[model samples]
Target: MKAISLLGVGICGGALIAAGCRKTNFVDKMAFKSAINNYYSTRQDCVWPSPVKFPVQADTSNYEQTKGYDALTDTGFLVRKAAEKKRFLIGSKQVNDYDLSDKGRSSWTAEQTQPGYGNFCFGHREVTTIDGFSPADVSDATQYSVSYHYDVAGVPGWASTVEMKTAFPGVAMDMSGQQSAVANVVKSDSGWQVNSVTPTD
Candidate 1:
């Protein structure tokens, strides 16, 4: 009877250990997904100049005395100017044209910071959707490997104009498409953090 009881206890202990491991893995997987989502959301706000050009009239008279003043042109110009100014103001927080927010900045690797590494220099990216998150391969208690798909629509900054493009041929202009990539998430002192992302052809 004593031996049987000991065996039963061992089996129960083993079962408990297995359950704990599964719970940990689930938590890690969610954490990784959250991290990736946060990263994509952060890039949604990129710095870019206005796309509209304002009209300039050479009339310095009363409000109704200007013959060449077009309201549409003036409105468009104001909107564009405001957008451009906002982009310039946000440039201080960007690196390699990517907006790495205060928390997300830690994930940037040296390769991403090198000159001419990213696609857009001064523009905002809109991640329309994210799907196809594969089952995470838990490497261990603290590391996980995963793959996912996402779509983005990007608008180039005013600097990406034809003249600017001619002068700086290497700069990337407006871009929109879907792409897949693999990422590694590791549990750091702060929390679960994405270590790297590699594009899959």
Candidate 2:
């Protein structure tokens, strides 16, 4: 009778272990981190022509436009020079002409559809910590608002310059170290997957 009781206990223990293993779904921190990192892998930092063509020119009077170019020039990604070019009918005017430097050409990803337009991509994000989550419901939880910290991975020197950070707020934010973000994750058949992530306000 004692041997039979021991066998029964063993069976019960096995069942409990199986049940514990089955509980590792979306609520698990490791699972959430994996999903968030996977989502971020597809997002890259890029600088594209806002509404103009490359090999472009911006009037010196246009500080907003010239500042952006000056920042990129500081990173050696773009070459800029002063010139006097003719306007529509305003005669010649002072402008800053910009073209891609050798470094920029190397990292440039040409747009497939738009022949002369492209962007310079820097890096993607990676999860640093899983801070907290909401809707603690485990049994029937279909979605979660996960607060977490993240950092930019594979950032390049050219994209980390003071000028680059100053000109591009996004770049500065990404490099600012251990930034917090909120990600919405939804339950799927396989597991919990990240729906979207946004910076924490």
Model 1 CA lDDT for position 105: 29
After TM-score superposition, the amount by which residue 43's alpha carbon in candidate 1 deviates from its true location, in angstroms, is 5.8
Candidate 1 residue runs with Cα over 4 Å from true position: 1-30, 40-140, 153-177
Worst 10 residues of 2 by lDDT: 44-53
How do the predictions measure up, each by TM-score?
Answer: 0.35, 0.75
Clashing pairs in 2: none
For candidate 2, write residues 40-77 as lDDT tens digits. Answer: 89877575424235798998998877887888888787
- N/CA/C clash count, model 1: 0
Q: Highest lDDT: which candidate? A: 2
RMSD of each: 16.1, 5.9
Off by over 4 Å in 2: 1-26, 48-52, 88-91
